[model samples]
Target: MPIAATPLRVLQVTDLHLKTQPGSRVWGVDVDAGLSAVLARIRERHPVVDFILVTGDLVGDEPDAYERVRQALEPLGAPVHCLPGNHDFPAALGQRLRDGLVRWQRHVIVGNWQFVLLDSSFPGTPSGHLAPSELGLLDTALAMHPELHAMVCLHHNPIPTDTPWLDTMTVGNGEALFAVLDRYPQVRAVVWGHIHAEFSARRGDIHLLATPATCVQFKPGTAEPQVDELPPGYRWFELHPDGRLETGVERVEPARMPASARRAPT
Candidate 1:
């Protein structure tokens, strides 16, 4: 196979959950400060990324909270694309985004890559599911972009999380999801949020990645609900001109008042 050539850089953020009121805390952490802190980290590391992908759960359903989150991202210097999570407000999202904002099941093609962002929010549930409309949309988009390697981003994990607790509420029609994905060999990766924990695995050629929350990460495989104290983080994907993607997570402490880490000797 001949190697394709065009570089693409993508930064993914998940589970910001910023509250509408400033200074409000989500899961014991000040969300407003957390949003700022995470953005600071992104700017420091990815000054000029090709694009930013917000995986979902931006504001914990406050509707107004998205303003704060969007404002924080304003200076990131790239096109910001988002998807909805189980905790996100679909109505608010629709209102806030521009008329041209890519709809729930649109195909965004850049260079040799096509990113398909899906909405997995179940109307009245903490968990998620892919409605028939969404599945059909995804099917059409993948078919149209068959020439480009794809990255599917959604709020829910379409694969088992193994934490029996979470596994129960994961994407309800995942097998159906995988069934569709199986038809598209050009899909190189599947990235999601919602789990809040950090995980990476592979099913055949498609790599799967889960990012840590902007405020917190859930403990992996725990029988009980738990939040990890590690600071918020993001992931960077460098898509080679030849269709191969090099990726890894970039984590930084949420900005601190006096700076938490011990300083070097003066």
Candidate 2:
């Protein structure tokens, strides 16, 4: 995991529903703890990562939650860029991440790859959308980097993940998103995080990925809302100088439990 020798490396974590404790009635219990564990693992394994993408769901719309999340991530020291998730307050989160965040407004070139983040979080809803204005920004970014390989990041999955219940709150303008991608064959991949399950697919030449949540993973294609009991995880990507993108998900072991609910070691 010596990323220093690599062209460019990025780590992404999403849907971290971090809360104060395990059983707190408050929205995001233990997501910060889970993220902390992931951060520790990442630092130990890949110390040379250039940047990280925490794609959204930073604080679950609570001012205190966002505050805690901010404090937790301040030590990582990477140039972290984030977008607003459905659970986040854009204005509030934007202010906190102003220095750390990058807008989806422009095409960011890292090595030979162009990274574009999409703010697909619609206000007051659990689903996502890319407004006309936002779409225009994305279109322009892709057009500007016609020859550069691109990756678009968003909070919600643009395509269905085969789970009927989880599919209810997907990106509203998926067809439009795809249409725009079709216009730009130079785009490399589309990465998303809302599904909370590890899945991947191909749309023509474009690779679509849905990464695991940092705390809990929702069972894939299940009718019941059950947890996978897997450890918090994140994804890493190595962008070669030749525009070839190599990425995979890494599930950290020994699920980090809150102090109040530690499981007994057998």
Candidate 3:
């Protein structure tokens, strides 16, 4: 692959967990407030973004809240691509988030990169499972775009976070996912949300990354769900045309979290 003059700059915001109500709380964190803070930080730090990738959980279980999500994201003035999380209603997302900057796009091609967003949200459960259709999508995308660097995006962590409680809900057939990617050398990274903490590892040459949620930070390596005092955050990626990439995470400043959300349950 030939390197382009400029790398594609992208922002990844995930697990928003927004609600229809103005001030909604999830696990003691005010989701709406957190999202607002995160977006503000993004606008301040990254003024020019090629596009935004929202991994999942755009809204809390409320189907009508997709409208709220669209309203919130449209002001950013950049194309927004999203996929559903376990807490989202897929049908509602497609129906309500069809216009403007927000869209439920499964595959996107930009510069020398191809982003394949998979839906791992299974009906009636928190766990994730990639149906054969999703795997086929991945396979087809990789086969069709052999020259472009590929990044696989989804809502659930395909690999374990080492947090036992969270691992139970990981992609049920992660081996199958890797099986497809292993065949393609152009695959650069596998990124996801839902663990609510930052995770980075390497499988062969592909980067395996799990980003922190925009609403809350979950304590990793815990036996059960626990909230951390770390502020809300998002991931940034600079994908080069030569198949090399640079990425990192940035959190909100001054730790504006409420006291109630700063501690783990006793």
Q: Which candidate's TM-score is highest?
A: 3
Compose the digit string of candidate 3's lDDT tens values, residues 1-266.
44457999999999988888988877777888888888998888888998999999998888889988888898988999999999899998988887668999999988889999999999988889999999999999999999889999999999998999888999999999999999999999999998888999999999999888888778889896677789889999999878898999998853444545433211
For model 2, the stretches where C-alpha displacement exceeds 4 angstroms are 1-6, 19-29, 100-107, 256-266
Q: Which prediction has more favorable TM-score, 2 or 3?
A: 3
lDDT of 1 by residue, 2-121 (tens): 343556888888888877788866656666676677788888877878788888888776888777766777677678888888777787787775443222334577877888888888
Q: Could you tell me which 10 consecutive residues in candidate 1 have the lowest summed lDDT?
A: 257-266
lDDT leader: 3
Q: Where does candidate 2 clash, by residue pair?
A: 18-28, 18-31, 18-32, 19-28, 19-29, 19-30, 19-31
TM-score of each: 0.90, 0.87, 0.95
- 1 versus 2: better TM-score goes to: 1
- Per-candidate RMSD, Å: 6.2, 5.2, 2.7
The residue-by-residue lDDT of candidate 2 on 80-104, one tens digit each, is: 7777778777877766556643321
Over 4 Å off in model 1, which ranges?
1-6, 99-105, 254-266
Q: What is the lDDT of candidate 3?
A: 0.88
Clashes of 1: 2
Full-model lDDT, candidate 1? 0.76
Q: Order of all candidates by TM-score, from best down to worst?
A: 3, 1, 2
